[model samples]
Target: MEEVIENPDRIEIEVTDVTNVIKPFKFTKDTSKSSLTILNQSIENIDIHEIWNNTTLHICADGGANRLYEYGGDKRSEFIPDFIVGDLDSITDEVKDYYKKQGTKIIPQLSQYASDFMKSMSLILLYFNGVEIVDVDEYDGLSKLMNQLNDKHLVNINSYILNGLGGRFDQSIHSINQIHILNQQYPTLKNVFINEQDIVFMIPKGRNLIGYNSISDFYKGNKFPVIGLLPFSPCIISSWGLKWDVRNWKSSMNGKVSSSNGIVSTNGVIIECDEDLVVNIER
Candidate 1:
């Protein structure tokens, strides 16, 4: 599989709306902000406070609550999570009591089948389906509510997850696996992993017009943000507005993996692909 540099003859296509997926990066206030989830990892160099202020819903995956508590320090009271969920493994009693007093819903998900991250996502899914967050007493309730709805499409709520990446190799791979599985099962549930240097998410299979609020600012600062169109499997792709744009290029893990690609357009980049791609926008 080789890159097709020449695409003088190509038909125009419709652009998918992915602006909402990248709204968190814009630093603009919105009536409907994305939800935030904290994982069990050190949030070094990440501004957790700014993200907390922008999110509508918040969840801490077990020990993640402890991380949040320690990170908040004296201002811990101001940074309460909406929900703390897990098998009661890592979350300390004092930390739990603190949040419990602040009216944080403590959910005990016992089944080890899904990780705390997945369980947290289950809560998000339940909430998006119009199910009251309080009614979900435990992990089983999550499945019960899910069965009641039996709907493929849940509310399209954008989610920003912190500390999900750059951890243990297996765990990081698990997080990425969850993102792929979540997108396949619930296409509307847009989950983005926000790390120190990148925002990772799945770009759907179709023509997509990817953009940022202040792309020209990056250019002005002489920092054209790097990007990638990583394929989970073999697929054909074409792109515009990138420094190394490709046309009808065949892509896959075995060959033609696109990475370290730069964004050159001041407006946005239009990527057309036959399969869903895992894209990482370098900060």
Candidate 2:
């Protein structure tokens, strides 16, 4: 059965760990829901304010806190992350104390087993649940809070927006992995990763119409955002909508792949496929 609930405050999406899954999505003004901006080490200072203004939640991963603290300077108050989380390895004492004094919660999850990115995600989930952080060092305390909320079915999540992608090749790939992992593991959370230029999201399997006010809405008339029908998984796939649109195009890491494709139509674009695929829009 399909379920739809009224949540004017957020957008919910499901993603998978497999690469090259093409699900359909439409970029509309109404689709602009709550944002979750993640600042990694690769982030730049120029767009910090813009991202901060557009997002409802701000998060800094391990070293991301240091970047924010340094780049945020006098404008630091304007872009304070609601929560600063990680293993506390790269986070400096001065940065931690500074944000804490500014009323930001510093969560230190020393579990080397889990990635700092994963811990940050847990904090985001907690924030959406409206749970105050009285302690960060209790044994499995955050996990216990999550479990209790799950038991009572009181977990509420907003659309998550991420920044700082396409920098380090491995970390960028890891970010994409989280995209698929969250979709499969926590199918209720909505996510978007914003890079230095474009916005990235997943399209689930089936027919999807990507409507926009204009192609220029995302790109500024230079050209349609660069798109790709990436097949990172073992499964072969095909795609449509490109200067060289494919018909029954079987794609995989080892087979024919679509990359560096541009939007040609003036009105909008349409992408249809049997599996989920990743879409990139150059900003």
**Tens digit of lDDT per residue, candidate 2, span 138-255?**
3345665666446444343444444646567887788777777776666555566666666776655555555454554666655456776665564434333455555555667787
Error of 2 at 29 (Å): 6.8
> In terms of TM-score, which candidate is strongest?
1
Checking candidate 2 for backbone clashes, the offending pairs are: 15-183, 16-180, 21-276, 21-277, 22-275, 22-276, 22-277, 23-203, 23-204, 36-161
Q: Which stretches of candidate 1 lie over 4 Å from their true place?
A: 1-28, 135-139, 151-153, 216-221
TM-score of 2: 0.77
Off by over 4 Å in 2: 1-33, 129-134, 138-140, 148-164, 234-240, 266-268
lDDT of 1 by residue, 1-283 (tens): 4454422222233346543233435433434636889999988578777678877899999999998998888988899898898887999999999999999989988778889999888888877678765556464666566665575556677788996988789998899889999888887778888888888888878877775555653234465778888898899998877777788899999997889877766656788888888888877
> Relative to the true structure, how large is the alpha-carbon lDDT of every model?
0.77, 0.60
Clashing pairs in 1: none
Candidate 1 accuracy as lDDT: 0.77
